[model samples]
Target: MPMKPAPDAPLCFHTLIHRLEKLKLNYLEIPAAVVQQLGGTFNIRLQCSVNGAEAFACGLVALGEGRGYITLSSKRMKPQGLQLGQQVAVRLWADTSEFGMEVPEELAELLRQDEEGDRRFRLLPPGKQRYIIYHVSGVKSSQKRLDRALLLINNLKQLPPGKEDFRAMLGLPPREAL
Candidate 1:
């Protein structure tokens, strides 16, 4: 079930920012349970009424533990006006499914034959799987994707779910590392 925002949750601006920073994540996962309520994958724009004005933002709905969190970059204009405990109404939706790559036949078969690989593959939501797929597919005119796929598969085979950072596991440097 989706965790509802409390009616009187205090607007703690610093706390909210702290939490966001603590996550140390570039993306936030939207729980699968709430995906439907937010219009599944159709709606893209979210409106938050703030300070007597409407603040609009673009976001991606990602899969979380049990429910989805509507994720917006802190760099967005809407985020600028947000305080910790404001009662802003958010209207959101998933916008696109074009970010990931198709599972290659050879890789698919390899995954199928390896029990651990199969388990990891099954555990990932379609969006995450698509993310990996698309990432692997994005390297054009080189064998980068193939190399990435091999590294990803090996990492998934070694790391448990909560510990995996698909980016780091693929041996990519952190944003700051670049």
Candidate 2:
């Protein structure tokens, strides 16, 4: 069953898209009241719809001008054919999916076929699982997705020391401390 938000949750709203190019943050402004209730977490799992297309998004709510804003990504924008200045009908609730996004079939089959990979993959946190799923799902070609899935499984099988190490597995260098 889908996880429902708290009773009378202020999670439902219609907002206009606003842009923040300098910060690379394009988002809808969420009400401060909702932010307070949500504990001001930037990475809040949301099951939202853009226009009419159903989308699962990780909302980044940032505080500004004594209010709150929910950031949207280009990835979600592209698929939904969203554009700036369009009205976005967003109805958010707590994320209930095993992975924040849907697991691609190509990757799913790969994990099922490889026992070790399946074991290790399930060991990682749901966020990490979503990271791998999102990355592999970005490509168009099934061959590429399979190859990326294989690569991810191989590294995940190694069991990276931490999140930073997990990035290294994906050929990403350690992030510099801010």
Candidate 3:
């Protein structure tokens, strides 16, 4: 069953952590009317103003029906000792998956360009693909991410399934090759 947001809407902005602490609400359902009320595909930054100071929250968006919900993990903000009617500012914008560590679209495109690339990659065990994706996305800098992604694609073209040259892909010398 789909969960529904309260009509009162908690002021459409803020809800106290203590009030929400024991609430094991997994998913917040936004009605279609609410989506129409707000423009489509918006970004929101959750902010907590506590003790006359404000702090930004690390949050994720969960899309459902026509509306989206900004979910704050407990780690980001503890929902304890929070006062009722506390202000939670939500700043909205378009969503961009590139803001965080994720598989590069360019890498996917590179794989798609080759006739057999997708097949070869798909044939590999899931673990291998996940390892490559993690390694490629783990780099902090954009240049490093791109470089690693290109190297991975090239290595995929050369190596057989189940056999990856991690050192070669990273431009590091292999023990034997060295």
Top candidate when judged by lDDT against the true structure: 2
TM-score of each: 0.39, 0.71, 0.38
Each model's lDDT: 0.50, 0.72, 0.49
Which RMSD values do the candidates have, in order? 11.3, 4.9, 10.9
Over 4 Å off, model 3: 1-102, 171-173, 176-178
Give the number of the best model, judged by TM-score: 2
Per-residue lDDT of model 2, residues 1-178, tens digit only: 2233652453666888878888986787776655655665556666665566665556555667546676787867887778887887777666666677778899999988999888888877767788889889989999999989988888777655454256755855567842
Error of 1 at 71 (Å): 15
Model 3: how far residue 152 lies from native, Å: 1.1
lDDT of 2 at 6: 59
User: Which one wins by TM-score: 1 or 3?
Assistant: 1
Q: Which stretches of candidate 1 lie over 4 Å from their true place?
A: 1-101, 141-143, 172-178
Global CA lDDT computed for model 1: 0.50
Q: Considering lDDT, where higher is better, how would the candidates rank from best to worst?
A: 2, 1, 3
